[model samples]
Target: MARKTIITCAVTGNLTTRDQHPGLPATPEEIAQACLDAADAGAAIAHIHVRDPETAKPSMDIGLYERVVELIREKNTDLILNLTTGPGGRFVPSDEDPAVAGPGTTIMPPEKRVEHVARIRPEICTLDFNTMNSGAQVVINTPRNVKIMAEIIRDNGVKPELELFDTGDIVMANDFLAAGHVEGPAMCSLVTGVKYGLPCTPDAMAMASRMLLAGTEWTGFGIGRFAFPMLVQSWLLGGHVRIGMEDTVYLGKGQLTAGNGELTARAREFIERLGGEIATTGEARQMLGLAQ
Candidate 1:
């Protein structure tokens, strides 16, 4: 039998904007519909991030997340939800006083960062282990803070998808696992193509995959132009795959995808063409050890 590969669609990320893709899902209704459509197009998992309806900016609002979840559950209960706990970690220092936070700073208490995940209790939530320069601001996920968030997510029966941005982050993840901060045989994602982080190259991704602890179920993906290529690379590496507007706006060069469903369909086609089978929701759930 051909290997079954799980595809996760990230509808709207915290960083992707409406200006970048006018069809981006901002409202709760739109976001829910996006997930449903992606599921219809062969995505077994929907990786999510909420945004303000009016401003279209990223939000930590529990109400928005609730609405999105409610809408998704109303139509499709089988699709696995993987919410993000990656917000509230960026720190932009002020020019006037480098010691003080700047306008873009969003650092908050670790507890607050996972508040939505605790309440929603999705099947999975991302736990970032990277603390590095991201654009003008620095994303800070200290070891102590990551541990606190991990405990909260585990307590709520949600799996943490360790988001590793660089080599050091992978080292941190191994340390966390050894210390019992995170469960062994973990679910992880290697995020490449981000400036100052892991470079989006075949060797780079292969090295990172080898560094992961044995039996770790991981997915390797890239941002922007590297998305599709790395998706294929990850599959070749015997890992799962991910795609959607959150990862890229274009389905092809100079052509924007209609929505999450289109991006997911494209990813499915790629996997099928390579002689791999896309897993159904139930199959994916079982593969991840998620409750049926």
Candidate 2:
């Protein structure tokens, strides 16, 4: 039997804007419908990041999360929900006073970062372990902050999807596991193609995968143009896969996807053409040890 692969669709990430893809789901209703449509298109899990309805900017608002979760559960209870805790980590230093935070700085207390996860209680929530330079700003996920967020997510009975951007992040994850901050053999994702982090290359991914703890349930993905290629690379490396507008707006060369569903369908086609089978929601739940 072909191994079953779990496809996670990340709809409307924090940075992906309407300018990049006009069809990006911004409102709660649109985000919920995007997840439902992706689930129908062969994605067993939806990696989510809510945005403000008016500004379309990423938000840590609990009400927005509640509405999105409520909407998704109303239609499809089987699809796994993986919310993100990555929005409140960027730090842009002021030009006049480098010691002070700039206009783009969004660093907040770790507890506040996972507040939505604790309340909404999704099946999974991403715990980013990278603290690297991102564009003009830096994303700061200190070990201390990561531990605090991990404790909160664990207490909520939500699995932390470890987001590893480099080898050092993987090392941090292993330490977190050993220290009991996160559960053993946790679910993780390798984020490549980001500048100053992991590069989108076969050898780079292979080396990172080798550094993970044994039996870790990991999915490797890339950003922008590297998305589809890394999806295949991830499967070839014996890991699961992820795709959606959050990862890329284009389905093919210069061809923008209609929505999350189209990106998911293309990912499913790639997996099937590689002679792998996409897991159903139930099977994905069982594989991840999530309650059925």
Candidate 3:
């Protein structure tokens, strides 16, 4: 039998991608619909992030998350929900008073950050493993903050999908594992193509994959133009893959994607062509060790 590859669709990220690509899902209704489409297209898990309905910017509102989750569950009760706890961590310091937050900053306490996950109780919630300079903005998720967020998710019975942008992040993740903050067989999302993190190279990805502890469940995501290529790379390496408008807006170069479903379909096709089997939702649930 061929290896089973799991496809995870990132419905909408907290980035300002809507302006860059109008196809990006903005409203809760649109996000839920996109997730449904992706699930129908063969995505076992849907990674979600809500945006401000009016401004189309990242939002930390629990109501938005509630609506998104309810809509997906109403449509497909078995769709795995992987809600994001990564927003509300951007920090752009003020010029005049460095300690004060600047215009782009939306920094909040760790408790406030995971408040939505605690309320919605998604099957899995992302726990960012490192803080790095993402372009001009600083993404801050301090060690203290990580511990607090991990404890909250662990206590709530929510699996933490550790987001590692670099090798050091994986080291930090191992720390959490050692402390028992996260369950055994740690789950990591190897984030590539971000500024100041690991470059979107096959060698880089392979190196990061090697860093993951044995028996750890992991997935790889490639941002922007590298998304599809990385999808193939990850699957070939016996790891899972993640794709969607959150990571890449184009189905092909210069061709805007219709939605997450298009990306999901292409990924499923690629996996099949590569002689890999696509895992169904039930199989993926068992693979990830998630609650039914």
Candidate 4:
């Protein structure tokens, strides 16, 4: 029997906007529709991040999250929901003073960061495990805050999709698991190709994968041009994969992707061609021990 590979479609990250990619889902309706399309295209999970309907900036508004979750559940109940807690971690230093936070910094207390997850009670939600310089601003998730965030998510009975950017992030995630802040078998996304973090090089990914705890359900993705390539690499190395506009705007050199569905469809092809089969939602749920 072929090993089943799980494909997670990160429909929209908080970074890109309508100006950068017009197809990036912004409003709740658009994001909900995008997840539906991804499910139709064979994604087992739809990793989501909501934006302001009017402005399209990342938002922590519980109302927006509720609507989006309501929409997705109302339409397709099988698709796994993975809400993001990554938006509230930005910290930009004052270029002038360098002591105080500069403009464009959005830092929330750990509980506030995962407030929607506690309320909406999704099957999975991202818990970013590291702080790194993401080129635009400093991504800050301190150890103390992460412990708090992990405890909250676990209490809510939502799985933390351990978002790891580098080698050390895996250790911290393991600590969370050991401390029982993260319950049961954990999942991780080995993020690469970001500035100041691990690049999309094969060795970097291999090292990061090796760092993960045994039996941890893990996925890997590289932003920009390395996105699809990392999908292939991750599947080949005995793991699942993630794709969509959140990780890359372009499908190829000059080809703009149609939407999250398009990326999801191609990712299925990559996994199948690698001699692996994509997991259905039910099988994925069993593998991850998600609540039915």
TM-score of 2: 0.99
Clashes of each: 0, 0, 0, 0
lDDT of 2 by residue, 26-85 (tens): 999999999999999999999999999998888889999999999999988889999999
Q: Is candidate 1 or candidate 3 better by TM-score?
A: 1
Please list the residue runs of candidate 3 whose C-alpha ends up more than 4 Å from where it truly belongs after superposition.
Answer: none
Evaluate residue 58 in candidate 2 and report its C-alpha lDDT on the 0 to 100 scale: 87
- Answer with 3 or 4, whichever has the higher lDDT: 3
TM-scores for candidates 1 onward, in order: 0.99, 0.99, 0.97, 0.97
Worst 10 residues of 1 by lDDT: 283-292
- Candidate 2 residues lying further than 4 Å off, grouped into runs, are none
Each prediction's RMSD over C-alphas, in Å, is: 0.8, 0.8, 1.1, 1.2
**Sliding window of 10 residues with minimal summed lDDT for model 2:** 281-290
Error in Å for residue 285 of model 3: 0.9
The global Cα lDDT (0 to 1) of model 2 is 0.94
lDDT (CA) per prediction:
0.94, 0.94, 0.89, 0.89
For candidate 4, report its TM-score.
0.97
**Candidate 4 lDDT:** 0.89
